[model samples]
Target: KSKVSVIETWLRKHRLLYVGATRHPFIHSIRDGSVDVSSFKRWLEQDYIFVRAFVPFVATVLLKAWKESFDATDMDVILSGMASLNDEFAWFNKEASKWGVSLTNVAPQKANLDYCRFLESLMSSEVEYTVAITAFWAIETVYQDSFAHCLEDGSNTPEELRDTCQRWGNDGFGQYCHALQSIAEHHLEKASDDVRKRTEAAVLDVLEYEVAFWNMSQGDT
Candidate 1:
């Protein structure tokens, strides 16, 4: 309870992701329900494109679990997440309709493209399992904490978007982040110093990209 895990503690000390998470105006807008429909539509559409690219990154993670030393339970959890993404996609489309945004014609913005490229590079077979999984855990935990914070008792998040916030911020997803943290810490325990360094460096890059992503969402970048 003191910390989500050693990795989470390390990430906290890193502080880069925390800055990225809390500094984004889009996040503040979400907390205050001040985000306009157009901005939300931009995010929803571009994220749909990002998610399309994200699917393969996740698929690569699944392959890593199979080929690496990860257990069956790990695979089960990943597969379950994979299955839910279909529903997540459908949700985006539904939300897009509500806002009159067209996901089909949308393109990934510069920040999103850069992040996707990083994710694609991770698919290289030469990357170690520990490093790959750490990236996974970092990205997921960022979203979990970012959105979950919006649901804090006084968040004042808009009624219409509360469910969207809950998609990642819910208690269930917090447990999921804890599980991912456990996995990342488990691997870090056995990781060589070089791998640990690489993991931390990759996490820094992720944080930067996340900030860029939020900037893009707010049309600031």
Candidate 2:
């Protein structure tokens, strides 16, 4: 039998936190078709800010992969992610216009500021590739899982929000996230014990930040 990967083991050990991040009340509301428009607007505005900060962090990871990864395809995967941000920003702008949420006037909430700061912290040259990729994977997977859940069978997700849901919940995004997971696992398998421990900690941190991000969306912060 194949050995369980480091991320798989961590997921099993921290299932509760993982569940909390992906199945938060904010997501539940969307799945149930009871989501508040105000909450959605708030989320749209704040997430745009988060994504803006996310771009540079992803760039840093791409640079790390280019310099440190043994595999050539790793840079391609990271670069594809970076390229998608252009479409992502466009979607955010359209959504903001639809929701009447002026993106220009939206201030970063405490949760968003804290989360962006965390991403900035990871961009330091001192951080190892193993730890950075672990974080990059965790961050994407949380959105992929949470948004995909809203598209699951029997979910009562509203028609108006279906496009938003499909943006991350679609099969293509799922496949992309899986590719990221594979790259993370590959590096993690060879990581030294100290770096592995740091990667595990980074995964946990990502989960906490995701949960807080959803909470901020719901105005629960």
Candidate 3:
């Protein structure tokens, strides 16, 4: 039986998450095993920058988790996720070598900058823990859902891309995303109506920004 999630239900009602999860041209092409090297490279470069900024954004969230939410398990998971970014950074460097691209001087593009700025906004004192963590869960799950499709039974995702896909799509990451969802849900349950609305809006904003970020990679922006 499938598990139920309030966030999942809310996201379904809105469709923003669905649009971001599916219909991303870059991810769709990867599923077909026909992603062009140029587009993939652009995605890699932009995503690397995003990940770099992601480190500190998540760190700030971890701080909030400690000071605000006081959820020990959630803090542990956030810490573990923060540790993994080191390996993720290494993977980007190694993957760049395999593809013969120089990532040494790449800069953040428009969509990525906007996304990072959104994270920065969440880091501000005005944003509550529920809103920030809701955004975190939404953003990570988008990538998880998008990439996991590539590993599906009939997917034509190329062997070369499968490793990258599985990096975010694998069972462990799925579990991590679930943990984040649980944390968000637990907080949301106690939240006032105003905070709940803000959280739902955060999810929508994350999806919109994610779709735009994907479009930027496809040169559609």
Give residue 125's lDDT in candidate 2 (0 to 100): 95
The lDDT ranking, best first, is: 2, 3, 1
* Deviation in Å, model 1, residue 159 alpha carbon: 1.4
Clash pairs (backbone) in predicted model 3: none
Query: 128 in model 3: Cα distance from truth in Å?
Result: 1.0
The window of 10 residues in a row where model 3 has the poorest summed lDDT is: 14-23
Provide TM-scores for the models: 0.93, 0.98, 0.94
Evaluated against the true structure, the overall lDDT of model 2 is 0.93
Compose the digit string of candidate 1's lDDT tens values, residues 70-90.
Answer: 477777766766876888998
For candidate 2, list the clashing residue pairs, or say none.
Answer: none
Per-residue accuracy of model 2 over 1-221 as CA lDDT, tens digit each: 98898889999999999999999999999999999998998889899999999999999999999889979899999988988888999999898778777889678999999999999999999999889988999999999999999999999999999999999999988998999999999998888999999999999999999999999999899
Among these predicted structures, which one has the highest lDDT?
2
Task: For model 2, give the 10-residue run with minimal summed lDDT.
Answer: 97-106
lDDT of 1: 0.80
lDDT of 3 by residue, 1-221 (tens): 98666786896797855665555878989999888888888988899989988988888888889988866998998888888788999999999888787887898888989999988888887888888888888888988989998899999998889889988999999999999889999999889999999988888888888988989888878
Ranking by TM-score: 2, 3, 1
